[model samples]
Target: MNLFHFSEENGIEVFVPRVKENRKNMPPVVWAIDDVHAFTFYFPRDCPRIVYTRTNEMSDEDHEKFFGLTSSDIIVTVETDWYERIKRTTLYRYKMPSDTFQLFDACAGYYISPQTIIPQEVEPLTDLLNRLMLLNIEVRFTPNLHPLRNAILNSTINDFGMHRFANAKGN
Candidate 1:
């Protein structure tokens, strides 16, 4: 167990790096899972059509398949969101008459809601989860056994007829 946990008066739990592990550079990203099954799913709004990976990685096979680009092509600079979080974070689009998928530009003709994103100053997962309750989003994972889950299931702790248990290899 290399993690240390602390909670403020507001019940927001914070996880910082373990000093002994030499993990000082890890930028914090809040995460929560009531059970292992919990995860997030991204949805595309309105249109029945689904949009997949958008990238400017000219060298990548997937990107090359979708776009007629070669590895030797000159690449452009990339931009990212305020949260500073994105997977494989590289690639900003170049304005082209034939391109219809570069979503953030003026030609897309979409207006965003003022409340589309949560302010960065607010605590992350806790409040967003409360709001998600109204939408009935079910986040779950396959059940697994751990000390905390075991303690929850056997919460009584009466030990009326408790016997020592051993690991699978008969420890």
Candidate 2:
């Protein structure tokens, strides 16, 4: 399986197995976090499909604290270019947050000196873990879509086939 690690400016890091092993019998399922409307795809393959009956009912203060931002403010910017990489890596990106956008620096990064720092904790456990479960499942040895599949939307793709098409189309 492939691994993906992302670090945010706020000392938050997210680690996930980009690709998970797919299995029979118990496939993956998509779960929605009602409060934030964030959806997570999970693989129930051989794992207990626990029924989280608890309501996603969070107080305004709790919700704001969880995300560290207001509802209308920029909580997290899911850039289009960032989704481009995810689409290539995960195949599907059209899941949550309909407000998708493209940014120029999505794939550009430079090291600041030679310093390394360890982080204390990461945010979005519920969001990341839920999405991870889905990513973990639906992974197969061959290129075949399985249950609970995902893809990115409104993102750039530079794959060989796509590149050929773009060259021909001249976009």
Candidate 3:
């Protein structure tokens, strides 16, 4: 399905996998977050792909359609670009409130960093033991995340989480 991301500065940027060139190849469901409305994902495949516009720039019908979309609404069709812009090396998830973000970052770093900066470890009784073990092993095969340590202090992405953070190797 088409990935619809809306932002005041960028307007609306749509994205879909180029390989399949079909909505069926896209995720069965998507959670599109924007200030306009909250769509909890699972809309039909034939849902529209309109570029979200500013409150004033949007037409009355378009505004009604967007605002009418409820949290449980599901989207169906998808297409667009920006796969080249997402960070390939490190994946990130963000939640509200800056303090929680900082804490999550620190926890992730302490548990995954090779430097062993943090001496604390999750107890064997907890589920984190296995997850941490897997994560620790995963880190060995993954690129160093140190470069992104200070990333939040200096973001390279737009409000929609995009940008050409790096060039392709063989380009």
Candidate 4:
């Protein structure tokens, strides 16, 4: 394991020179709020709508069929609450107008809120989820091991449990 980790780290270091050269000389637009929160680079708020990617389990075909873009379209530029301490990162994506979908400049959002944040944030999931590390509420992932232990009975919920477990895995 030590040898493997050492080789991996060495390989990453070897790539650092190329990575630095490839990096664009751009100013940092995103601003960090406290230690956990941050905001996007100051750009025209009225510009083209930004795209967001769908969930991991969502296939490329299904995402394009439903939302017209793969999961990579979404960009998460900020997070502002204690949830960061819990390793729960929140992401956001903006959607544009096109066939099948009617809304223009709509915000198609999602969040990785844990059980810890549910009791802390007061607003609805739609409103509170857009911003990260939302101090407005105390939240963390719920500890429900029963469903996880009995995962084989229901595959869909089991998948959800897996996702939730994945989010909390580091802790």
Q: Using lDDT as the measure, which candidate wins?
A: 4
Which one wins by TM-score: 2 or 3?
2
Q: After superposition, how far is residue 112 of candidate 3 from its true place, in Å?
A: 30
Give per-residue CA lDDT, model 4, range 22-139, as digits (tens). Answer: 2246222111111111122111222111122336566555455534532233332211222233233223222111121222112221112111111111111123333423433222
Per-residue lDDT, model 3, residue 71, is 32
Clashing pairs in 1: 37-140, 37-141
Candidate 4 weakest ten by summed lDDT: 1-10
lDDT of 2 at 37: 21
Top TM-score: which candidate number? 4
lDDT of 2 at 47: 19
Candidate 1: tens digits of C-alpha lDDT, residues 29-141? 32211111121211111101111223343335434443334332211111112112223222211111211112222322221221212222222233322332344433122
* Lowest lDDT block of 10, candidate 3: 107-116
For model 2, residues 42-65, the per-residue Cα lDDT tens digits are: 211121111111113544444344
Candidate 3 lDDT (Cα, 0 to 1): 0.23
Q: What residue runs in model 3 are displaced by over 4 Å at the alpha carbon?
A: 1-54, 70-171
CA lDDT, candidate 1, residue 98: 15
lDDT of 2: 0.23
lDDT to native, each model: 0.23, 0.23, 0.23, 0.24
Cα deviation at 94, candidate 3, in Å, is 14
